[model samples]
Target: MQRFPFRFAPAYRLPALLFGVTPGTARVEVDDTELRARFGPWSLRTPLTNVASVERTGGFQFLKTAGPAHLSFADHGVTFATNGDDAVCVCFHEPVRVLDPTGRLRHPGATFTVADPPALLAALEDLEER
Candidate 1:
């Protein structure tokens, strides 16, 4: 299994603690069959095959992606962020439900502020080649 911890900015750490999101609690883990994430109380799980693509991105507005999971109003993408710096956006073949409780609202992509963006991206890419 490949695991990546979330990057916690010094300024954001205190706020994250309130949501029960610490470095130990927020992480993304990938095994042969599944990709699982735990960000405080929110979690996202999907089959490895469901992953379509991954890209590195940044420049986040604090209000939009500071603490818990945030859903994009424009794209319906969910962001599991701890910091505003580096993040990897993973697009899925099929949209997954998150942010909404009814299970009707699904997101086509998810962005994670993992500690190592390149490593996480490379890991997913290597899985694709296998």
Candidate 2:
């Protein structure tokens, strides 16, 4: 499968670093069967088949954080995001594991910032058609 790649928008760096996130090192790659995201030391991959939903979002708003960029974890759902604004949230059919910057495993779904979200979505849709 060919790798469809996209960089994250530039605006997320400072906020991400402020919350202890690696910041400014975000990228995504979509292949025929899975979607992968990387931000500094953190990485996540989910089989396309396991994805239950995907949505474009304005990202976290008014949500105070002890650490806005902390690794995300959820037993039933996971959301991996780079910045607190402008993100793509993915939900999976079953609990999935993700690797954080510390290489620890966490479950559920993941989110990431994309430079061109619509293009990513279009790529996913194309993959679904295959």
Candidate 3:
């Protein structure tokens, strides 16, 4: 498994801990067949084939992505954010379960504040080539 860790901003480090999200526990792992993500109490797992696309993004709004996993009211997308800086947005071909406890609600995409967006993107891109 290839693991890509999340980046915790200096300010976000403490706040993220409130949700049990620390540098040690938060990361995204990818393999030949599947992808897995862990953000303390939250997680997102799906087949690598489900990934539709990946793009680098940054400059997150604090209120929208401060701690834990955030759900967008407008887009219904889930965000597992740690910092407001560099990150990658992973879009899925089919919506997947994320925030809804009952597993009724699903998200079209997920954004993560990984330490190295390029590496993450490259990894995802490689999956597409295969």
Clashing pairs in 1: none
Best by TM-score: 3
lDDT of 3 by residue, 74-122 (tens): 8898999999988899999998887887889999999989988899899
List, in order, the clash count of every candidate structure: 0, 3, 0
lDDT of each: 0.90, 0.56, 0.90
Model 2 per-residue lDDT tens digits across residues 2-66: 34233333454455566445534456777767877765555667788877767776546433212
> Model 1, poorest ten-residue lDDT window?
59-68
Each candidate structure's TM-score, on Cα atoms with residue i matched to residue i, is 0.95, 0.63, 0.96
Q: Which regions of candidate 1 deviate over 4 angstroms?
A: none
- The better-scoring model by TM-score among 1 and 3 is 3
lDDT of 3: 0.90
